[model samples]
Target: MIELRDVHKAFGPKEVLRGIDLSIGKGRSMVIIGGSGTGKSVCLKCVLGLIEPDRGIITVDGQDVTRLRQGSSERDAFLARFGMLFQGGALFDSLPVWQNVAFRLLRGSLKRPWTEAREIAIEKLRRVGLSPDVADLYPAELSGGMQKRVSLARAIAAEPEIIFFDEPTTGLDPIMSGVINDLIREIVVEMGATAMTITHDMTSVRAIADEVAMLHRGKIRWTGPVTEMDASGDPYLTQFITGSPNGPIETLR
Candidate 1:
């Protein structure tokens, strides 16, 4: 489980996260929804220690991880338990698919022999609907959807306990987006991993989230079960989910 208490962050004159307080339950999928510049990704990065909050605490399973220094052994060990899928595929152009998937396993605390790591990588590729032949292909040779699949394969290759998905459905056609959404949902459920996803796609949220939280003005404007989201009646939540232009959430700069 993860908890953020009164978390706050700022970039000089511009304040990003004002006071974000949210929690994700064990083995549950929580989707964060918000308009652009609402600090949804910032909140996630703060929890991940990529961006340290100026104030407040972030705890993972009762341990405060916000204080953990970056590049420290403690931080590395803590982060080893998490896997992340970035908005862009973020694959290495130099490495083949299998090597990219097995990057963590080839080094660090979870190091494994080359043969074993390759076997696991191939198995993960299969789980993400990629074939063994695809493993030898470079990232440049794959389609956008295929690249995303490879990224997914890499994320789950280590069987991390917690996974963060950043805009998983971005940059894909409708059909491919739907395929990725369904795959993400199925894999999360089958792995029994705690998940936190930041996305603007309502369809993706509905398909992948057990609970939904809306971020607005750098704080959690609404939080509830996915089933109750449509009827929540919060103006911000309503306007966001319905994609309305004339609500408390301003569309214009």
Candidate 2:
């Protein structure tokens, strides 16, 4: 469903992605594990066409992502197939929860009457374990976990064919993190949508990924089925997954 071939990206003197070659199959879940500045998010942005790769190719659903001109109908159509849950909940504080969830549905190509959009928003909220009553509240009125769930609801509201989660379980209690993880897994399977997630949470990785790829020094260090991750015997991956301070990965402290 998605492929990156020898992808390279750099900002001025900083090289982020260096020949990243990876692919996620249709309806499969692939999680990227890496430390800060390792280019996990940059690779994702390249595929989304938010950042252009200086070298190599990125393709999604057989279309060359690099070739799609920004702001064109083709680019809009290309992006319409994806739903994203940003690192932060990113909800509009002024809008009620339901309106935030239905934000996409009320505008642009997916636009619908306010009444219909609200109904769909409510249904999606339910799918994410949120009650209809909570829909009338604003983001500031909700707890951290509830807000994240609302973000999840919004991501799936459009019924996208692909979903990208950027740190889906950040800034929550352990139980809430687990709840979000389980919900993400369930939704991906239920929707049969291809999933790409970048997170530092090992638990989320184990819960959400069918396959795991570890990026080190702007390149793929190790990648395999999640089942084989523990036994991959790669120092870079071990250092990452185990959170060990000592390994091929250099530490500041």
Candidate 3:
């Protein structure tokens, strides 16, 4: 459903994404794994039109996203088709919990009256295992795991066709991470949503991905089914998934 072809991004002298070429099929979960400083997040940002690439094309269902008109009706419509959960929760500190969850419903095409929006938000919150009463509290009143659940609730509130999850399992205890993983799996399967996730957590990969792609040195080093990742024979992939400091990946100063 999403395709990136020869994508390149640079900041003056430093090049981040040299030429990323990958595709995620419809209703499938694709997980990207890579070390720090790799262009995993950059790839997502380019597709979202948050950061324009200096070269290459990105398409969704065959539409060229790189050439989309910014701040126009078309751009707004394109954005409404997908949901994103950023690496950090990226929740608005000032908004109450329900408002945050109902953000798109309140302001976007799904715009509804306050009572209706809150009703939808509460239902979505419940789907992510949060109590309806929590909707009245601010983000600061929640724990890290709760904030993650809230973020997850917000991402799925609109029941988007596509979802991008950045480090979904980060900053959570193992149990909480497992809970999030289960929730991600359930949502992707039940919603039939095409998912693209960037994470270093192997458990999350096992739980959420059908295929896995490894980014290295500004390109995809390996891409395959998760079942074969551990035995891929690529030294870089082996080192990364095993969390070992002993292989092809070297620490950058």
Candidate 4:
């Protein structure tokens, strides 16, 4: 459903993504794993059109996204098809939970009447294990896990065809992380949506990814089914999955 071909991005003299060729099939969850500064997020932002690449082609369902003009109706339409759960919860501090969930529904082409939007937001909140009473609460009132759930609710509110989850299990306890992982998997399966997630959490990757791709040195170094990952025997992959101090990957740098 998404493809990146020979993608490259640079900031001054430093090159981040160098020929990153990757693809995620329809209705599948692909999790990208990489160490800090490996350009995992950069690749994602490039595909999302939030950051334009210095060179390459990024396509969603065969449409070249890099060519889409910012602020154009076509660009807006392309973006409307996607949902994103950022690394941080990224909720508006001023908006209530329901309004935050319904933000997209209150404006733009997907806009709906206030009553309908609120109803949709409440339903989505319930889907993410939040009670209707929680809808009136603010992000500050919720626990870390609850805030993450609210973020999840907002991402799926519009029933998007594609969802990008950045570090979905970042700050929660183990049990809460497990809960979020399971919820993400269940939601993706039920919605039959294509998913792309970037996270260092291997447990989350195991629970959520149908396929796994490892980004290294500005490229996709290894990629395969999650089932095959254990036996792949790539030194870099082994080093990362095992969290080893010594291997092909230079952790000190």
Candidate 5:
């Protein structure tokens, strides 16, 4: 459903992604794993048009989106098909939880009347294991795990065809992170949506990905099914999945 080829991006003297080539099939989950500054997030942003590539082609379902910036109509159309859960919960402290969950549905063309939006948001919240009573509370009032659940509810509220999870299990405790991972896996499989995730969490990768790609030095060092991840043979893949400090991936100062 998504294809990126020969992608390259740079910021002044720093070149983040160089010749990145990867693809995610329809209705499957593809997870990219890498250490910080290896260009995993940059590759995702290039696909999202949050950051444009200096050169390369990115296509969603066959349409080229390499250059569709924020204001372009095509970009808007492409975005309508996508839902993203950022690294942190990213909920608004000022808005009630329900409003945050329904932000898109209450403000965009997907907008329903206030009452209807709340109903939809609440339903999404339930799917993410949240109770109706949590809807009126503010983001600040929730625990980290609760906030992450709320963010998940928001991501799926519009029932998007493609979902991007950026460190979906980032800050929570291991148990809570596991819950989120399981939920993500269930939702993606049940919806049969194309899902792409970037995470350093090995557990999250094992739970959420059908295919795993390891990024190293601004390029994909290995790509294969999750079953093959442990046996990838490539030193880089072995190092990343095992979380070994001594490997081809250098520690950042």
Candidate 6:
């Protein structure tokens, strides 16, 4: 449902994405794994049209996203088909939980009656394992796990066809991360949404990915089904999943 062909991005002399080519099938979960600063995020941003690539093409459902003008109604409508869960949970500190979850519904083309939006928000919160009472509180009142669940609720509130999770398990303990990973896997399957996630968390990758792509040095070093990942025998992927200091991949220390 999504494709990037020969995509490239650079900042001054530092090239981030160098001729990236990738595809994600409809209703499939694709996880991109790599160390920091390897351009996984940049590749994602390019697909979302947040970053204009220096070269090549990106398409969603066969529509070229690169041509969409930012702030134009067309772009807004195009973006409406997608939802995002940022790494930080990124909730508005001042808005009540319901408001934060119903943010997209309260503005732009998705606007709804406040009462209806709040009701939908509550339903989504419940879906993510949060009680309705939690909806009236501020972000500061929630723990990291709760905040992450809230962000998850917000991502699916609009029932988007595609979802992007940026380091979905970041900053959580092992158990909490497991909870979040399970929730992400469950929700994506239930919604039948196309998912693309980028993370260094092997646990998250193991729990959430149907297919995995290893991004290294700004390119896809290896990609295949999760079942075959451990035996793929790609040196870079082996080094990454094993977290070994010795291999084809270099580590500074």
Candidates' TM-scores?
Answer: 0.98, 0.97, 0.98, 0.98, 0.96, 0.98
Model 4 C-alpha lDDT versus the unseen true structure: 0.95
Model 1: CA > 4 A from native? none
lDDT of 2 at 90: 89
Local lDDT at 160 for model 6: 97
lDDT of each: 0.93, 0.94, 0.94, 0.95, 0.91, 0.95
Q: For residues 1-253, what per-residue lDDT tens digits would candidate 6 score against the true structure? A: 9999999999999999988989999999999999999999899999889889999999999999999999999899999999999888999999999999999999999999999999999999999999999999999999988999999999999999999999999899999999999999999999999999999999999999999999888889998999999999898999899999999888899
Candidate 2 residue spans exceeding 4 A from truth: none
What is candidate 1's CA lDDT for residue 102? 94
Who is ahead in lDDT, 2 or 5?
2
Q: What's model 3's overall lDDT? A: 0.94
The 10 consecutive residues of candidate 4 with the worst lDDT sum are 244-253
lDDT (10s digit) by residue, model 2, range 162-221: 999999998999999999999999999999999999999999999999999999899998
Output the lDDT of residue 74, model 1. 93
lDDT by residue (tens digit), candidate 1, 1-253: 9999999999998999988899999999999999888898898898899998999989999989987888899999999999899888899999999999999999999999999999999999999898999999999999999999999989898899999999999889889999999999999999999999999999999999999999989889999999999999899999998898889887875
Error of 4 at 155 (Å): 0.6
Per-residue alpha-carbon lDDT of candidate 5 for residues 40-123, written as tens digits (9 for 90 to 100): 888988888888899989999998897666777777778988888888888988999999999989976687899999999999
Two-way TM-score contest, 1 vs 2, winner = 1
Better of 3 and 5 by lDDT: 3
Off by over 4 Å in 4: none
